[model samples]
Target: MKRVPLYAAALGFIVFAGFPFYWMFITAFKQNRDLYVGAFDTRHVPWIFNDPPTLEHVRLLFGQTDFLRWVANTLLVIVAVVIITVALAVPAGYSLARLVGRWGGRLGMGIFFTYLIPPTLLFIPFSRVIALLGLQNSLGALILVYPTITVPFCTWLVMGFVRSVPWDIEEQAMIDGYSRLAVIIRIAPRLILPGILTVVVFTFTLVMQEFVYALTFISSVDRMTVSLGVPIALVRGDVYHWGSLMAAALFTSIPLAILYNLFIDRFIQGFTMGAVKG
Candidate 1:
C-alpha cells in the first residue's frame, strides 16, 4: 500500500516533466485545421487526435527549409566548442587545483565570476572583435565567440571536480617515475572522465541553444544555427508556423534528451562531487 503513493508521485512527476515533449509531438503532427479549430471548439479535445495526423509540417521543415544545413552547422559548432572548452577548461582547472596551491580556489572563483557576466553585456564587445577579425556572417564567428562564454565556467567546474579527486593516485603515479605531464596525460584524465563528460554535455547544449551571439554575428540565412535558423525561417513577420515550429523543436530536442539520458549518471556525479569539494 505504501508503494502506491510512491508510484503515484513518480507518475505525476513523469507527466509533468514529459508534458512539453508530448505537446510538441502532438502539435508537430496535428493538422492545421484540427489544431486551430480545436482551439475555438471548447468541446474538442486538444491532447488527442481529433483529426488524422499529417506529415505536412515535417515535410515543410525538411523539404522547404535549410534545416539539414542548420543541423550540420549546429553539430560543427558543438564539436569545435566542446573540444575547445574541454581542452582549455581541463588544463586551467588542473593548474588551479594542483599547481597554484592555496590561492587556486580564489583564482578559480575569480574566473568563474567572469562567466556570471550576462551575455547581453558581452555581445556588443564581442561583435567588434568578430568584425575586426572579419568573421562576420561565418561559422568561424560562432566558433570564435562561443568559447568565451563556455571556458571560464567550465574551468571552474573542472577545478572543482579535480579537487574531489584524491591526490593519492597521481602522487603514487609520480613516485613510480611517471612525469607530471605524463601522469596528467595518462592517469589524471581517467580519474576525471565524469567531469570531462559533464563539460562536453554542457558545451554541446549551450552551443545548440545560444541565440544572442548567433543573431548578433550571423546575418546570413545559410550560416544560421538551428536555434536562430528555425524561427527566422518559419516565423514570417508575426505569422507563426506553429506546426512547423513544433516539428523543429521536437527534432532538435530529441538528440539533447538522448544525450542527457546517456550521460545522466556521470553528469550527476560530476556536479555532486564538485559541489561537495570545490
Candidate 2:
C-alpha cells in the first residue's frame, strides 16, 4: 500500500539519525579492550551486551579534573549573560515596538545582523580590548564577551513579541489610574512570558556552548568553562581519552535536554510569535 513505503522511510530515517548517539552511549560504557578490537574482527566482541560496564571514565572525569569548577564558571557566566540580556533587551524591544517608527525597525534589524558576523573575525580586536581592560584569564572576560551575541538576537525577538501584543488593553489599564510603567509591569507580564523564556533559554545555551571567546580569553585551568574544560582534561598531547570525553559530553547534554523538554511548549510559541511578526 501507499502508507507502507512512508512508514518504512520514517523508520529508516529515525535509525540513521539515532545511530550516532546510540553508538556514543554504548562506547562510553565500553572497555579499552573492546574499543581496541577491529570492527571486522570476528572475535565475538560483545559491544551491545557487554556486562560489568565501568563507571571508571565518569569517575575519573569528576575525580581528577576541575570539572565542578568548570561547571560553576559556566553557570555563573550564563546566569550573568541571561540577566543582562533580559534587562537590556526588554525595554529596548518595547521602545522599538511602541515609540520608534520605520527607523526603529531598521535599527532592530541592524542589531540582529551584528550577530551574524562570525566570532572568528571579531576575536582579535576583542582580545585586544580584553587585554586593555586587564580581564585576561578571568571569568569576567567571558561575562563581557558573551553579551555580544546574546543581546542583539534577544532584542529583535522580544521586539516582535512586544509588537504583536495589543496596545488597547495596556491603554485601558493606564486610564484606570495605573502609571505607564505600572501598566507595562502588570499587563505585559502575561503576553511577554513566552518571549522572556525564549530569551533565557537561547542565551543560556549560546553562552554554554561558546568556545572561541572562552578559549582565547581564559587559559587558567581553574577558570575554564565546561566547553573548554572537556577537551583540555580529556585530550592529552597526542593521546585521547574517548571514554571520559564521551561521558563528560553525555553529562553536559542531559541538563539541557531536561530543560528543553520542560518548557518546550512556551519555547516553541515564543519562537513562532517572533518569526511570524518579524
Candidate 3:
C-alpha cells in the first residue's frame, strides 16, 4: 500500500518529463487544420489525436528542405567530435590521473572551467580565428572548433572516472615488469569503458545541439549543420512551417534518444560514480 504513492509519483514524473517529446512526436504527423482547429477548443486537449494522422508534413520536410544534407553534415560533425573527444580525453585524462601528481586535480579543474566559460563570450574571437583560417563558412571549421568545447569537460569527466581505479593494482602491475604505458593501455580501457561511452554520447549530443559555432561558421545553405539548417530553412520571416518544423525535429531527435536509451545504464553509472569519486 505504501508503494502506491511512490508509483504514482514516478508515473507523474515520467509524464512531466516526457510529455513534450510526445507532443513533438504527434505534431509532426498532424495536419495543419487538425493542429490549429483545437487551439481555442476548451473541450479538446490541444495535442490529443482526434483526427487521423498524415505524413504530409514528413513528406514536405524532406521534399522541400535539404534535410538529407543536414543529416549528413550533422553526422559528420558528430563523428569528428566524438573521435576527437574520446581520443584526446582518454590519454589526457589518464595522464592527469597517474602522471601529473598533486597538481593534476587543479589542472583538470582549470580545463573544466574553460568549458563553463560562456560560448557567447568567445564566439567573437572564435569568429575572427575562423575568418583568419579562411574557414568562415565551412563545415570543416565546425569539425575543427567543436573539440575546443567538447574535450575539456570530457577529459575532466574521464579523469575523475580514471581516478576511481585502484592505484594499488597499478603499482602491482608495474612491479610485475609491466611498463606504465602497457598497464594503462591494457587496464584503463577495460575498466573505463562506461566513462568513454559517456563521453561519446555527451560529445555527440553537444555537436547536435551546438548553435553559435555552427551558425557563425556555416552560413551557406549547403554547408549548415542540422542544428542551424532546420530553423534557417524551415521558417521565413513571420511565417513558420510548424508541421514540417516539428517533423524535422522529431526525426532528428529520435535516433539520439534511442542511442541514449540503449546506453542509459552505463551513462548513469559513469556519471554518478565519477562525481562522487572525482
> In order, how many clashes per candidate?
0, 0, 0
Q: What TM-score against the true fold does each predicted structure earn?
A: 0.88, 0.88, 0.86
Instruction: List the candidate 2 regions with Cα displacement exceeding 4 Å.
Output: 40-47, 261-278
Q: How do the candidates rank by lDDT, highest first?
A: 1, 3, 2
Summarize candidate 3's per-residue lDDT along 1-278 as a digit string, tens digits. 68999999999999999888888888888877778774567876676777899999899888888888888999988898899889999889888888999999889888877887877888899999989999888888998889988898788878877877778877888899999889888876877887788889889888998998887778888888888988886776788888888888888888888887886665564446345432
Over 110-206, each residue of candidate 1 has an lDDT whose tens digit, in order, gives: 8888887977898999889888999989999999889988898789778877887899999999999999999999999999998887899889988
Candidate 2 per-residue lDDT, tens place, 24-55, comes to 67767777776657777886564573456788
What is the C-alpha local distance difference test score of each model? 0.87, 0.81, 0.83
Cα error, residue 219 of model 1, in Å, equals 1.2
Between candidates 1 and 3, the one scoring higher on TM-score is: 1
The total number of steric clashes, by the backbone 3 Å criterion, in model 3 comes to: 0
